[model samples]
Target: MARRGKKKGRPVSGWVVLDKPVGMGSTEAVAKVKWLFNAEKAGHAGTLDPLASGMLPIALGEATKTVPYVQDGAKIYRFTVAWGEERSTDDLEGQATKNSDKRPARAEVEALLPAYTGVIMQTPPQFSAIKIAGERAYDLARGGAVVDIPAREVEIGRLEIVEHSPERTLFEIECGKGTYVRSLARDMGRDLGCFGHVADLRRMEVDPFTADDFVTIAELETARFGEAGRGKPSSDGQAPQEEIRLPDRFEDIDALLVDTVVALDCLPQVSVSDDTASRIRLGNSVVIRGRDAPVEAEEACATARGRLVAIGAIEQGMFKPKRVFGG
Candidate 1:
């Protein structure tokens, strides 16, 4: 018998800003989008918890190469913290382990915000995805083991209370990578003497992608189906309710795809010539001679004819290709 090769899907490429629905895990959502696009490859920039919903940047095919750029960008989250109850999972997903009778006043809560702002140390929730000794901390916690996750420093660019009520307080935070909103709620409750857990969470922005760029799964499905005309009529002579249509060609799904270069928008750009692009594609560094080249930057995106060629550093008037695109 001969070995068989794995089946490959279409070579669909680009980013899809999915407005993930609550209760769907990040992996599940990625799989759904991958299937909907029938893409050969797929990945996501950031992992959003099942309880939280909002902008999830999904990269298909070549766009997967730009995931790290988007992941490293700043993130904004709006969450609600319910006072008086602490859950094992740090959110509404786990059992309540503690309670409190005290609710901090609006002024009091505002006063404590400064202490958590800027750079601060935070301990991740025990029931989290953090790995411990080759095992996930959450797995150990679920098995009746006391998981002690280490505290690490995270940057909070901005933190403010969006709303405050007697039972819960809504807050919005802009933070750098690795900052956990659930942990923020947990620590705030501890600081106020009213143990708390996240009641609800929604990510509003992830770097280049904002609320405006988000596309609901329903909308994506409708667009895919509407373009593919895969909807079939039922016995009632009405078309069956279609969740999404699977496109047969990559061009058919162009409306939903975002250019790969959009992920590198934060970096400085250097315009190169066609010859320079060819050299970069061949893993060669080219001397910066164009007028559009950035004067100075730690890293930059090189484009030729308005197409992303590479992302690399410029040294001594030379553009080096750390990662080449469209190769």
Candidate 2:
């Protein structure tokens, strides 16, 4: 194979919501956006199947740092279930194993839907990205080997029957991060004493994002070209530039993006003195004057408070590191 050449791209920092197109894998979409933005550092917050489409958060530049923030967020999808067959992949296009002669009505689907709501244990489909012996489970599945995958906990916050037909069923769901709609369809079919497979799947929303938040590759290109064409300055000598831009508006931009640190807005802010800030910068955990305790700098990452409970007002005063915690 020819050696891959040096990567050439611009660097952009911040999060950009995208409207993913169907039939394209999540990685493909992310690469396309990286090229569109010419950014060297970019990552997607969540993965969507080639058969699925909708709001996918693309982290550009430092925004990628917040991937964990939204990775576990609640998600929603609009999917179509074909009520007569089951496939190896749990969706259409895969080899099907079972078929049914009976048909299910919309009322029946609605009535059975409530059983999926709330906490539920679900078995992930064999054709998925789960790991088996440190290798992708899908790889083993495609090789024709059977894998006895175990069931895992996944929550379906809501499941609604939108439409039903003799040939197909369309429904929507809000579920936990790892819930598989394909598996849900298969299980639904089993419950109905028939067979079912996902005919179509489209993610409609993710935290801080929705179908309305997504941007397609075409749209991203258009936006870039639009910026390139915007030679007219705002005359205030403060418009914006392209290809490379800093997140000076970090506050507002992060408003649309998920927060790396949980409860940032709800947490109190302690003004660190020059010396204290310097010490914290050096990775030293220090104690704040108030709050009844001292904590490592990382602990502030949680709520700006140390190991102890948050005290009263936190004025603009210098603070030391408490403890290092997750963002």
By lDDT, the best candidate is 1
Q: What is the TM-score of each candidate against the true structure?
A: 0.90, 0.73
The per-model lDDT (C-alpha) reads 0.85, 0.67
**Runs with alpha carbons beyond 4 Å of true place in candidate 2:** 1-11, 226-327
- As a whole number from 0 to 100, the lDDT of residue 213 in candidate 2 is 55
- lDDT computed for candidate 1: 0.85
How well is each residue in 34-128 modelled by candidate 2, as lDDT tens digits? 65555677788778888787877888665565576577778889999998899999997699899889888877788898789998989899998
Candidate 2's displacement at residue 185, Å, is: 0.5
Give lDDT tens digits, candidate 1, residues 230-274: 652333222347663434654545687878888999998888888
After superposition, candidate 1 runs with Cα above 4 Å error: 1-7, 227-252, 295-297
